[model samples]
Target chain A: MLTNRRTLLAGAGALAAGRAFAQGTGAPIRIGLLHDLSGPFAGAGSVPLSVGAEIAIELFNERGGVDGRMVQAVAADSQSRAEVAINEAERLVSQERVDVIVGVYSSAHAVPLAQRMQAQGKILWINSAIASAVLKGKHFTHVFRPTVHSDQYGEGSIEFLAEHCERATRIAPTQFKLGIIYEDGPYGVGVATALEENARRVGMPVALKEGYSATAPDLSTLVTKLRRARPDAVLQVGYNPDITLFLRQAKAGGLRTRMLIGHGAGYSQIDRLTETFGAEIDHFCNVDPAATQMLDPSRLTPPARELQQTLLTRYHARTQSNDPPTHASMGFNNTWVFLEHVLKPAVREGGGSIDAMRRAALGVDIPVGGTIQGYGVKFNPPEHEMAGQNGRSVAVVMQFENARSKVVWPTPIAGGPPVMPLPAGSPFALR
Target chain B: MDPFLLEAIVNGILLGGVFALPVLGLNLVFGVVDVVWLCYAELVMVGMYCVWFLYTQAGWPLIAAFAACLPVVAGLGLLLHQLVVRPLLSSPPITQVLATGGVLFILQGGAMLIFGTDFRSLGVEMPPMEVGEIFVSGTKLIAFVAALVGAGLLWTFLKFTYVGTAIRAIARDREVMPLMGVDPRRIYLVASAIGGTLAGLAACLLVVQLDVHPFIGLSFGPITFMICVMGGLGNMLGGFLAAFLMGVIISTGGFWWNTEMSYVVAFACFIVVMFARPRGLFAR
Candidate 1:
């Protein structure tokens, strides 16, 4: 009896020690992914982003996660509400105890959530929100964004226009009259402000600038205004419904423009637009991060090419979409960067402390064509105006032809020359 | 007038046409049943989804799908009346309103469960028609003409048919209509079905112009209610006229200022009208 009791005690002691060892070394790294998975933003690239982030984490874990510790993702829906996003972020930090939080789809939600996460001193890696105000002049140490910003979208559109205006439209860049219209939200306002500023810097004349509610039932009056202004090209920023309304109204009002350029959001869903407007939107140009699927594999690093292939294959299997939207690449590439570059090294250095994570993030330096999206990874230092922003991240202008997007700007990466002034067959084309 | 301003006015009238059917439906239900179906717009949303499913998914012809939408929505209206509104007919107006509000959430949640949040478009567009200096959307013009025809048919039914006369009588005097050998319950059900049919008609028109999502109703719902109130709650003609007036105001406001401000101007106009009339613009 004495011998049996002693043996039981020994077994219990061994089990306790083994559990402690597992807790200390083999525990999974918890990442909180906050995105609008079930709200209005879901269809506007949020779902793709969530799916992409999940895929990246899955791939990382399959390859034997950060330094032998598996990575886990805790996803919370923002419901497209800023308050909900903040509350969920707080829960993920205080309750779920996530080491890093990533993936916010809307700038409106990102603005407040970033501030909250920064105050809490928790690391927040932004995957998709693009408003320049999200990082501009806010030298945040804990927040890092590795995707194109709204200012890039603004500048990219103008640059594309300036470079290709004379050649394609027979209109000088200086004489080009640009019309700016946008939904009066943070994303739209940010892009519109940047577009106006960049256009002014380039000495391009802006014919009309208008802001409308995204939920407005009628855009006919705005269409009438556009008709009156008759701008050489119209730059619009809006989500799905408003863009559709504007296009429908523009067609009805015969609001002719030399070209119609859109910045991300609704514009990225070229297939949906094509399904609606058919050939009318064939040459419509959209400024956004290049979908990695559209980029030439030869230009990307060997690893990046493989990653792109895997992402596309998995994404297509999941979404049944042949052409993966740009958001998927942004989500996958940014989360992959965080996991491989920042989290892995941080854990290796010292138990994945927030400070160590910060150091690892700052130390990341990759040249162009290194990532799946063909953008490099180099966060602006904390001392910089837009600290924690990926300064090297770029946006490209892509034209939709036959419901497929082809990059047409930034000469180095462009698949083909832009079709400017639209084709004569388009109703919006200049006669 | 500037041609642009003229264009805005014309566009406003066209927008008015879009608002007319929904306003008439709401007014019709309020007139006969005396219970506000706050879920009216949601019913329209469901009708839109039905049409989209039949036409796009089930591979039915567009016109056939549209024809099927009317009866499907009318049956839904009958079910709603039988299931929800009927039980609450004896309750206070506030209670009825709350019940229908609950139904609104149910419908929205159900749609979310089924269709998800993806915006589904019918992907049908008609070319613009040029009328001198004014350009008009072919889709909007068709919707406008259909709304007028629907309104005319409704007026004809009310004036000529025995059942329609009974519905009118119930709206006129709910207490006395029972004494006049007309069953108020049957009349209410008929009015509700007709209201649903109008909503379905509006849905058919709207699906072509705008993409249909679950929350698409919120875009035009509030304005519709305001139009109903402005025209006098039970007065169909007043609601019809008010829809156009509101449409012109909103469109012209958009013309003068911007789209967001235009809605503000519209609501402000509604407040001013309410302050002056109290009951409605055409209570008598």
Candidate 2:
């Protein structure tokens, strides 16, 4: 027993010694967070993403730093332009010599930056942005994304609904009137295809469809057209304002339906839309991963849970604001995932040069936020898609209810039953 | 297909009346000034953003927001003409194109820096108008009627007003117009100013229908420029006619191919039209 106690103490001592580097170092080791601070996505995409990313870097330092080196995040706002994204990425690499770069808001910005990542030999950590094309090629050799791709969002939505209906016997597969009311764009098109295919596999027929321009002056015409089809559910697609326009039009039209689901626009600048629509959005549905659910008080992994809570508490304390729903939590997890899984291990084995770190970043196994959804992340060499079964695990069916959105579908992580008998003929419902 | 195609065409023509504000004024400038006035397309963009800035930010009423867009954007037009157009007036056509191109950049840049490229849409407080499953917007109908009336008023001014005739006279004979009691500079100013004001009005109407963004101006600029050139460099009738043709092509292409390609199809058709009838649909 004495020997065992001594061994345990020695082990504790060894672990303490081991944590000096893992705890973060005395000197700062740089990570770069480049984002659109003053451009289109600034409100939801740029500021919140950057703030969340910053909190993560701050948390790393407070934990004795990553590998005993203070994890410093040097940030630059790309202004949501491609040239600016490339320029800031170059600056981060040359001036700061950052180990990782996080928070790009547009696919237009990400595709080119991915190419830059390959050439510079650096790790690109992607969180939330919808440019489906980013997952198409292996150009960004040093990048790893933990979020679901655009295509999978639709597929996941269909799958979730199918699984739910099968359990509840609400709608038979044959009569499932799946419909799509989508923005006419590439990302929208990809999602549309995913939904159609997935719905078909579940034996549901996509009955009604319309592709409207996001730039349309008013969505009334589209809403009227969508109403004509009288679909069971409509998959309303677009970015922030598209969602807003559809919701407002649906409300004014007094259209009701079984379910109303927005495309994966839940984590966007949805606050504006919520403010405008008021309680009307309570019945609305949107697709965003249950990232925070994984960080719940009960289920956090040893190091990860502590890290999650520390960052959440410290961030709220410093900002004097509530911890962002999943915004900061994703950033914090993404940063830690990049460092703990890729950077530190590479440095221990291969000296953590830019090339070494890039190589290691490729081999990461991403697990979903256990408290959120069960998406454990893994990537295959030359396989660029950041989604499939594991990625789908965390996709919680979310509804905006009572002035706040919560996971309301696929129990186990769900807070409440879906508000069934959703407002009749919901223009934004996905069939 | 239920003769809805015919109605779509009729409504498409009616829609052209509203869109003519940009085509007519844009071509008017091109006819006399020989500059494309790329920024003219963005005049509507400026108007929309200004309205959005007022309504959403300053909490102004929609009508007030619409009212404020005109004067502010009119001043913007005057500044653009004075600072940008005047500097490049004597240079080659390429230089003139580049100068007006700079205007597009400045306006778009200002919008981006201020607004950060998020979308801004407006509520008209009216439901969509439908005639037996033919879905159309109440806001769009109003814009069309307003556009038709505005276009007619401009047409009357061109035919009857002294300054308008002088402006027309200058378009016909730029160098010799001074003998006809027309100051080329004043005519140019009036043309650009009128063009700018119309663009601002269109901008307000557009925001009520769709969201506004700086990048959206880039999307609008090239197409309107094409409309002017494809219709005929300086001919209003030609500009008006080709506007519908291009719109139909876009609506069809957006259905058949892809959204981004709507611009490409219109531009490509412009190229094809230029190849078949190099002078455009109407002879200048």
After TM-score superposition, the amount by which residue B275's alpha carbon in candidate 2 deviates from its true location, in angstroms, is 2.1
TM-score of chain B in each prediction: 0.98, 0.89
Best candidate, TM-score-wise? Answer: 1
**Tens-digit lDDT track of model 2 for A1-431:** 01111222233233334443455446555667776665444543455555566665555555555456765556676865679889999998888777678777656677778777867767777766554666565535566676666666776678667766544436776676766877665556666767777888878777666665554433443444445456667777675455665666564444445666776543334455554555656666777565463335455455556665676676566444432555555556666666666667777778767777756766666554432234565654555344211243355567776656677655666776766546433343333
Per residue, candidate 1 scores C-alpha lDDT tens digits across A137-178 of 999999999998999988999999999898977889899999
What are the Cα lDDT values of the candidates?
Answer: 0.87, 0.64
Q: Judged by lDDT against the true structure, how good is candidate 2?
A: 0.64
The weakest ten consecutive residues by lDDT in model 1 chain B span: B109-118
Per-candidate total of colliding backbone pairs: 0, 41
TM-score per candidate:
0.93, 0.82
Per-residue lDDT tens digits for candidate 1, residues B34-127, read 9999999999999999999999999999999999999999999899899999999999999999999999988887887788777888988787
TM-score of 1: 0.93
- Which residue pairs of candidate 1 clash? none
Give me the runs in candidate 1 sitting further than 4 Å from their true place: A1-25, B179-181
